[model samples]
Each structure stands twice: as structure tokens, then as C-alpha cells.
Target: MPKTLDDELHTAGAGASGRRERAASVPRVAWLIGPALVAGVAYLDPGNVASNMTAGAQYGYLLVWVVVLGNVMAWLIQYLSAKLGIVTGRSLPEVLGARITNRWGRRAYWLQAELVAMATDLAEVIGGAVALNLLFGVPLLWGGLITGTVSIALLVLQSRRGPRTFEFVIMGLLAIIAIGFTVGVFIAPPDPGGLLAGLVPRFADTNSVLLAASILGATIMPHAIYAHSALTRDRFATRRGGPGARRDSGDPTRRIAWHGFGISRPADEPAPAPGTSTEVPTGVLVRATRWDVSIAMAIAGTVNLCILLLAAVNLAGVEGTDSLEGAYAALGVALGPVVATLFAVGLLASGLASTSVGAYAGAEIMHGLLHVRVPLILRRLVTLIPALAILWLGFDPTLSLVLSQVVLSFGIPFALVPLVVLTAKVGVLGQWRNHWATTAAGVGASVFLIVLNGVLLWLVFTGA
Candidate 1:
């Protein structure tokens, strides 16, 4: 006798359970994508574009290794941050606040998050203004003002939709960057040897080191870490599940406590029951996160890799780029005006979108560390002012933007340590605790970045 319809439903349910299991393993591959998306936006920020061009133009492909190395280092740190949130249920800000028993420790975390915002905001405004400047012969001051106002408006536009709207907008910006840069590459094909040389670590003179620092620094962001951890929790919480079934409270530390995560609980919740054994829902977890992470990582990582290749090809040994506009001028000579214009437009979008994220991160830090509930608009203003000043000071918009990358290089340490410490604490992650291998890698990477930054700084000061 063949099975009836009822039996089919039972078998279908079992199959669905396996998908959920896979999804649980990966957590909506989309979740993994959020960080990469954020990274893409950061990678295309004003400073990154300028520095990458300079590296490519000056040394051809000698500095290509910086992009790979930086991304690898950053990937290591970010992966740990993600793991920390998934296992601990607490974001970086929350954990930092919790860890520092003393006032000084608390102050350091908050202050650094604020610094990250300030520096990030500065880069964004400058990037945006430079775009406007390149697109239309606009004055830097006016451009900066407009840039600041418009970014705040973007946040307001998304206010009704909730916070992650900024991230969505940033994703769109990343697309623009990809299109523009890809077009630029098509225009000026890269030389194979210079491009290959760029993939290797070279210590050729002092300026190379500074440019390399900028590239590495591009990955080190305090707020991105805070934002990543928080976004995971926020996304989890919003996924139609309650705390016990889903643990979605933007705290990476709460994995087992989620209920509304589309899973059902006996009685009221999914808490530990002494005598009853609970079967994990096959439908809920698997189809959700795994695939999303796969696509997101691929998109973000590919873009980063492409950018480095793009820079190595176009700018390597071309010369005379005092500004991003200058870099554009060079690109126009090698490539074409149309491609350069597209790049500027994309750069504009990247800066503005990332600006909004910077503001949100700054506000979160203010709220978490200082317990100060500042208005979002005010926070935006606070973050943008420095960037505005930089433009007003008659500084080269492109160079200032590139130097800001160096600021990130110095700040990476502030964010990395707490992430490493919190994730490695076995009590927080339980069985999800970082393996000894992962810990060693994290420690080694952090130390290397620290040393790299130091040498870069020494070179910068010596003007070699």
C-alpha cells in the first residue's frame, strides 16, 4: 500500500527540517552579508579611493598586496565580531560597557566609538563634497554644507522604515561604486607585471608605507563593529520570533533565547526544561540565514578585490594626483571623461550613505556609554562639523580624505581588543567559543596591524 496524503505532509515536514538545519548553521547568509556590505561602503569611502589610486599610479601593482592583506585582517576581526554576537547575544558596545568596571574603561569605549564616528563623518562629507565639486564647479564649503544636510535627510527619509534603512541605502551605493569602477577598469587596462607586483608587500620608500597604511586603515572601523553586532541582533529580533525562540535583541550574546524566530515553544517558551526534550523546528532556522551570508560575502569581497585591481591598473605610475579630482583628471587622460564622471557619482553616493551609518553609530555610542540620549539630528551635526572644517580649511579634499584612512588605521585597535576578548570568553559563547586556532590567528593579526601602523606612522613623520 502506498502512503497517503497525510504521510506525504509528514515527509515534507522532515525535509523542510533539514533546510532549517542548514539555515541555522549559516544564519540567513544575508546576515553575514550585512558586514560585507558595510565593508564595501567603507572601502569606497573618499580616502580609500584616493589612496588606492595613488598606490596604483605611483607603484603600478606594488601595493596590491595591501588590499588583500587588509581585507584578510579585517575579515578575521569582523568574523570574530559576528561570532561574538551570535554566541553571546551582546553587541560590541554593550559588551564594552559591561566589561569596563571602572569609569575610565567605560569612557575609553564610548570616546573611541565617538571618535570613529567623527573621523568617518569627516571622510564622508569630504567625499561627497569632492563629488559635487567634480560634478559641478561647486565651492568646497558650500558642497560640504549641502553634503551634510543631504545625508541627514537620507536618515530622516528612512526614519519611518527603521534604522537598518541606512544599511540598505549603503548597499545601493555599493552597486554604484561597482558599476563606476568596473567601467573605469574597462577604459584603462592594467599592466600585468605592475599589477602582479602590487599583490606583493613592498617597502619601496616612505610614501608607499603611508599609502599602505591608508589602505589597511580603511578596514579598521569602531562603529562598523558596533553597528555589525547591533544589526545582527536587530535583524534577528525583527524576524517574527520571540526572545526565547529567536534571541533577536541586537545582542550577539543571546542565541538560544530566541522564541519569535519562527520556532514554537511548548507552553510559553523554549527555555531549558528539566524533563522534556524539545525537537528543533525544521522549517524555521535553515531557510533563513545561510544562503544570504553566501551571496553577501561574495558580493562584498569581490568588490574589494576588484577595487584593488582597478587601482593597480589605472593609477600605477601615472603621476600628479594632489586631489581625487586630480586623480579623476588623470583617469580622464588614460580612461575617458565619461568613466571618470561615473566614478565620481558613485563616490558621492558611497560617502553619503556611509555618513548616515557613522551618525547612527555615534548616537549609539553616546546612548550606551554616556547614557546621553542625544537627538539623531544633533548627532549628525556633531559628526559632520569636522569634515566641514576640513574642507573650509582649504585642505585638498582628496588628500584629507586619504589621510582619514590613516586615522582608521590607528583606531582599529580600540575596537579589535574588546571583540577578541568577549568572543574568547568561554562563559559567554559556551560551546560556540572560538577555537584555539581562531584565537591565535586573531592575536597574530592584531599584533601585525599594530606594528604595520607604527611603521607607517614613523615613515609619515619622517617624510620619507
Candidate 2:
């Protein structure tokens, strides 16, 4: 049989495990960083840069709290995603596909999910292309072609180096982004009092509210929601390769660990069922995964915060500076060419890392929803055509980035509702199911997203 997403992830994860064995002196906390970091890349993609920068420039530090709230919500969603994978051993798409029995229903889901994936790829491609244009003065059309090609090359490289190495490369790029923005933040520090005040949460107007929705759309990506589950489940299975690999429930020790972590199987999913068992303690994995997600997301959150702060300090009240390129040039004038160049370089890093992730999510969505597997290069090509078309048609690159985020906001409900519904179910998740508090939070987040989308629509039509 051809390898499924789960199969490939397991193989790659096992390879990572072998490398871990060779470097036995590495600390325990180090092992859990891969999945979370990989998934967290979505939070720092070009769409986020545009949204956060726009927010800061237009509203000063007023919208910082939205970013904070969005990241906190993302932490919860991603943790649930990791738990779902670890316990059920399926990606979100796979689970969605299995539960919806109607053939047409599945196809409809696939169509919308594919559109969401494309919107995701669109942001990554254009974001990277804009970076190249800023750095090298390349034309946007040619820049997009180069971005698509290089991103696929990175994907191919990841396949060759194995999952762990691929993760390290992403982390390396993330470090560049962090350092770049951190420098920007320090060089042009916003008011400490204003920064503290920004965290109190107040929308300046409908436009600010629109930007908040865009930031939310960018922060908690639909693709990352699907990808995290596949990543965590497969990596754990690969690392714990042994007999009874699937029979994880029999280990009373593991069950206690899960309970200790505030996770439990539902009454319906009793341990030691005829065919279910676990290789290692699920609770240990849960605890480790939580730490991994917490650290990775915290880093991501900080980076996003820095973007908004930098923009507020440098770009506020600057006319005709709504786009990334505009912001880059404005920083050059305000700070110097060096700071602007660093900003471009960080944008480049964000573009490359995120586009690669977008490809992975595209593949998982295809496989899970359609039961069809396409080559990664082919999928990259499919997503590239639309981006190239956008550039070819003379659309502004930065405007394209913002508009793509709007489409993503429209798609959020489709992904979030199903996730919340499934993760809250006892039959599906057993003791690993979300508790009452989590379920409430998940529901509230879902409603928040929907309301934001509604406001976006209202703002678009009313021009308010």
C-alpha cells in the first residue's frame, strides 16, 4: 500500500528518534519541541506580519491585546489538536472524513478545505515573493515564481533530512525572525505605559475590529489545526515503536500520568479493550507535548508582539505605508537601511518556513478528505498558479496578502466547529476528551471567530 500521511510521519518521526538516541545528553525538554514549533510556524507567517503591522501602524499599541488573546486561544486549540492525535492516532481531516458518511457531504467538506489550504498557500507565496522584491528589487511576478520554486526545494530537502532535521531548520529560521524583530523592538521602543495599556483590550473603531479579526484568522490557522494532530500522533508512535504500540490503554501507569495532567479517557473508552494498548505512558507524552506547545507558542506569541510593537514605533501616522514593502521602507527612513534590511530578511524567513508548512497541510487535507495522494511538488504547483495569476493581473502584493486573510476568516468556522465538536465528544476521545472548561473555551472561541467574520462582512459591505 502507498504510504499515508500517518505512515510517512511515523517513518520520519522514527528517524528523528534514532538521532535522539545518538545525542543522549540532550535534555528531556528538547524532545517535545518538534511538532509544536513546526505547527507554530503558521502563527508567524506573512499574513500575520501584514495584519499585526497594519494593526500597530493604524492603532498604535491599542490592538496588542487582540494578538495576546489570539495566541492564548491558539495555545488551547493546538494543545487539543496534539491530544486528539496522540489518543486517536488520526489527523483531524481523517477523523472528519470517517465520521461524515454521506459521500456528497465529504466532497463538500473537501472542496471548502481545499479552498482554505489554497488561501493559506497564497499568503505564504505572496509574502515570500514580497520579501524577495524588497531585498533584491525583483519584480513581484518573477519573485513569486522564485518563492514557489525555493519553497518546494525546501520541502524536498526536509524529506531527505528527516522530520527532526527539518524541524531544526524551521527553528533556525524562527530564530532569525525572533532576533530581527527583537532588535527592531529595542531600537524603537514603544511607550512602556502605552504597551501595558494596549493589553487592556478596546477596539478603536470598526476598522480596528476588522484588523483584530484578521489577526485572529492569521494566528489560529486552519491548516495548522489539521497538521498538528498528524504530527504528534505519528511522532509518538514512531518513537515508541514496539509490540502493543496501539494497545496503550493497558498501562495503568500511563493512565495515572494522564489523570495527573488533567486528562482522562471517557467512560466509554475503558483501557485494556480487546485491541487497544499503548507502548509508553500517554500521560508522559501529554505532559511533554504540553511543555513543547507552551514553549513554542510562547516564542511565537512574543515574535508577533514584537512585530506589532515595531510597527507602532516606526510606522504609526506614516501615510501610504499599509503594506509590508511600505513598512520596510518607512523603517529604513526612521531607523536606517540596516533595520529595514533585517525586517526584509525576517519576512523572508517567515515566508519560506510557512509555505513549506502550507504544503504539508495541503497534502494531509487531500489524503484525509479525498483518500487521494498527490505529489508535494504537484500540490505546490496547484497552489502556485493562483498566486502567479494574482501577481500577473497587477494586484498589489500587500493588498493580496490582506485579502487572502479575509478569505481565511470565512473558512475558520468550517474547521473550528468540527474540531470543537469532535474533541468534546466522549466516544471519540475517551478520557482524552476535552473537559468542561476546555469545551466552554473552545465554544467561545468558535463564536468569537464567527462574530469576527460577520463583522468583517459587515465592514466590507457597509464600508464602516
lDDT of every model, 2 decimals: 0.64, 0.79
- Write down the worst ten-residue block by lDDT for model 1: 20-29
What's model 2's overall lDDT?
Answer: 0.79
TM of each candidate vs. truth: 0.81, 0.86
lDDT for each residue of candidate 1 in 373-408, tens digit (9 for 90 to 100): 788887787777788888778987777877887887
Candidate 1's C-alpha runs over 4 A off are 1-36, 163-166, 238-301, 460-464
Clashes of 1: 54
Location of the lowest summed lDDT over 10 successive residues in candidate 2? 255-264
On TM-score, the leading prediction is: 2
Candidate 2 regions off by >4 Å?
A: 1-27, 238-279
Deviation in angstroms for 199 in model 2? 2.0
